[model samples]
Target: MTFSRGAVEEIAAALAASGLILRGGFSFGDDQVAPAGPSGAPAKSVLLVGQAGAAPWPHFQRWLGQQARDIANPLDTWSREVIGAVAQGRGARAVSPSDRPYLPFQQWAMRAEGLKPSPLGILMHPTYGLWHAYRGALLFEDEIPLPDAHVAIHLCDICVEKPCLKSCPVDAYSGQGFAHEACLGHVRGPRGEPCRSGGCLDRNACPFGTDYRYPPEVQAFHMAAFARL
Candidate 1:
């Protein structure tokens, strides 16, 4: 069950064929214990799979809708089914950001890709702007070779405009800090329809990767999730 570098790429390519990118990955030996798996077995290494922009939205949204018709927690079910299948086929364990006693996904992402946070707290991707996300990750019981880590440019540092700070109607985000209560109140108020129906105007204002912005439907979907309804 040992996985070679070639096998890693093969699994990555297979997931890519389904529109999921093997965003970045890391490896650790037995000396470096990984988080416990669902059965409480320790993981040896991990592969990070993610999506940039709306690459998987169309397919994922449709699948999620169908699952919602038949399941209670469609989002969780969809992620597990989609990502778990890949992990299972590769003889690896699957875990998510939402898993109880959550794994340090942000740290993992930083180590894997050298990502930095933007003003809005979303990771500023060099290519995807504010339009990317880490969907899930695959955990392996056996050690796997990691690809070379990248040194990504922190785009937010160079941008003087910082439009993300100005775009929110309620001034929810800024260099100072996020006004979480104000943001939630605004989104739940009478004037919140625009933000409720679309996504965060501040997030949409990030000029790094405008072309990768999520479609209206995808935007609305995430906005609703943020609203917790």
Candidate 2:
């Protein structure tokens, strides 16, 4: 079954109210494990939901204010609540990046967006850069008509300086993959105040998509979460 353009627009509108955007989608191939639908059949399509930069900060802050002070995984909880509602209203299943037995969101994103990973391991979009995120996805039982796929262009290939790899104090990303312990240690230490207050120096060093960069507060929130985990 094909979903009409109006149906897609309606979903976009609903997500926009909460500062989320439909980040494109794709139909599951025969070889892929399409998530099970309500009737225990495989879902045919997936519409990715995400926010560009700090677009969802206000909406998230407002919702955060009303929740319990000791809530665990508040951001993920909020995402599930918001995306789950949209999914339920439209007769679809909701999945998140944080879900156990993870749904290969990174691979799915690259497929849907034609984006490639930067040295930092984040999907580097031509427009959003390192500042965007995938909150959740809506899975449908039928194939939904989607817009054309993005043309992949790896910006890092042409970059000369590659500032991102050099900016980290701990050399956490020294072209040898991320040093998780070193990163965690520094971010939680006193010397990490700069990163704690602003954000990852390496991430901020990226010159692409500067306009979509997240604000200091938003970055700080994510940094705090990272330090804890």
By lDDT, the best candidate is 2
List per-prediction Cα lDDT, in the order shown: 0.80, 0.91
TM-score of 1: 0.90
**lDDT for 98 (candidate 2):** 96
lDDT of 1: 0.80
For model 1, the superposed segments whose C-alpha errors exceed 4 Å read: 29-33, 37-40, 68-73
lDDT, candidate 1, at 132: 84
Candidate 2 Cα deviation (angstroms), residue 84: 0.6
Best by TM-score: 2
Q: Per-candidate TM vs. native?
A: 0.90, 0.97
Candidate 2, 165-212: lDDT as tens digits: 999999999768999999999999989999999999999999999999
Cα shift from native, residue 87, model 2 (Å): 0.8
Lowest-sum lDDT 10-residue window in model 1: 67-76
